[model samples]
Target: MSHLVLLSGWGCDARIWQSLDGHWPTGVAVSAPDWPGYGARPPLDEPGDLAALAEAMSAALPTDAVWVGWSLGGLLAGALLDHLPAPRALVMLGMGPRFCHPQGVTEAELAAFRGAFRRDADATRAHFLRWQLGGEPAPRTAHRRLLDLLGRESPAATATLATGLDWLASLDVSRVLADPPCPVWRLAGEHDPLLAPEERARADIRLAEAGHCPMLSRPEAVAATLADIAQRPEHSLLEATP
Candidate 1:
């Protein structure tokens, strides 16, 4: 049986896939890796960046696992793809080639997120919901659950992650996709403000209306896509350089 390793976006818990449980295609065993400071996992040290953290997390999975990631999780999945011991596949959701602005982020943007994480927790939560669901709004019950997760997070750690966007400022997957050996599928919401539709269109993308977090809003469709990829044959051997 094939193993599916799910990497979740920043600040989100493994609960992101709760709705899609048991929906994966047959012959697949799905596991959602808990990001540092998120899910039930312990937080990492101050200097532990995503790359270092990813290296540590990858040790938990078996070699050659299919990686499905959303947002920051997608970035990590792509970065770690070549390093992993096994065959890999990438399914990116709601993430563009670069997250930070080309010229770089202003102090205002960075400070605002930091302040929201500290003084006005509700606003931070609301902002996150707005960004992820494209203002479609999560249910009140689900929204509260997300709030709990946010409450559990360390402000310093989350802030450090916010500061880390600079690492992805200039990243684009075009060169990587130019002649990808492994199968890659990109999914995006037409109204996704985080990752524009135009950017996602650069890859083999699926359009939906659920904003950034379609896995929650369009669980059935996302589940079907996962199943589709799981059934496809491995393509790593096809990536040999000419």
Candidate 2:
């Protein structure tokens, strides 16, 4: 059976992918479990340790399922290949190895946001949630959908958010993407004001009429693409032809 485990990004819980529920192809099983401190799970003492976090998740998340990660979650999923049993493959959505890109959030901007988060975590997270949706074709509609999803999920603690920021600041998966251990597929929003890994991925991988939160703005399209990727051969025979 083809199984998929969806991971949510920072500032949001697993419910961020709530819009994609029931959209997957038949026979494909899916689950979006909360990261530590994001839902019923208690906040970890050190949320900054991606490897450790992935290790902890390994107990619950099966290694056989394909892992689908979004934004910061995408980076975390990429790290999973090293710590836990490798999943069938890795699928990234509107995310890249580097979060601090000139086109996305720069180092300076990230630093400033860190400072702002320290001062008022609530305000900073609220602004970020809205900012990420600005590139959607119908920004207000997307924002509303996100808000509704968030309303059902427990908010991450301020300390957890700070550590998440640190993860974003420190993570750089350039090498992994360059020579992925498993078959990897990348996706990004054409209009994303944040990180757009457009240059690294195929042109067709860029979702139209979407932004950083394409799952909210274009859930059906995202689901279709993920299903297509999951069904492809992990090591295509075509690649062996010299």
Instruction: Give the winner by lDDT.
Output: 2
> By TM-score, how accurate is candidate 2?
0.91
Residue 222's C-alpha lDDT in candidate 1? Answer: 80
Query: How many collisions per candidate?
Result: 1, 0
Q: Give the whole-model CA lDDT for all candidates, comma-separated.
A: 0.61, 0.79
lDDT of 2 by residue, 1-242 (tens): 67888999989998888799878898678888888988778876677776778767886568677788888888888877777776777887777777888766889999999999989888889888889998899998998898888873337888888888988899888887777767676778888878645443443378888888889989999998887776667575123111
Candidate 2 achieves a global lDDT of 0.79
Give TM-scores for every candidate, taking all chains together and pairing residue i with residue i: 0.74, 0.91
The count of backbone overlaps in candidate 1 is 1
What local lDDT does model 2 show for residue 30? 83
Identify the leading candidate in terms of TM-score. 2
Worst 10 residues of 1 by lDDT: 233-242
Cα lDDT, model 2, residue 106: 83
Off by over 4 Å in 2: 152-154, 196-204, 236-242
Q: Give, for candidate 2, the lowest lDDT window spanning 10 residues.
A: 233-242
List the pairs of residues colliding in candidate 2: none
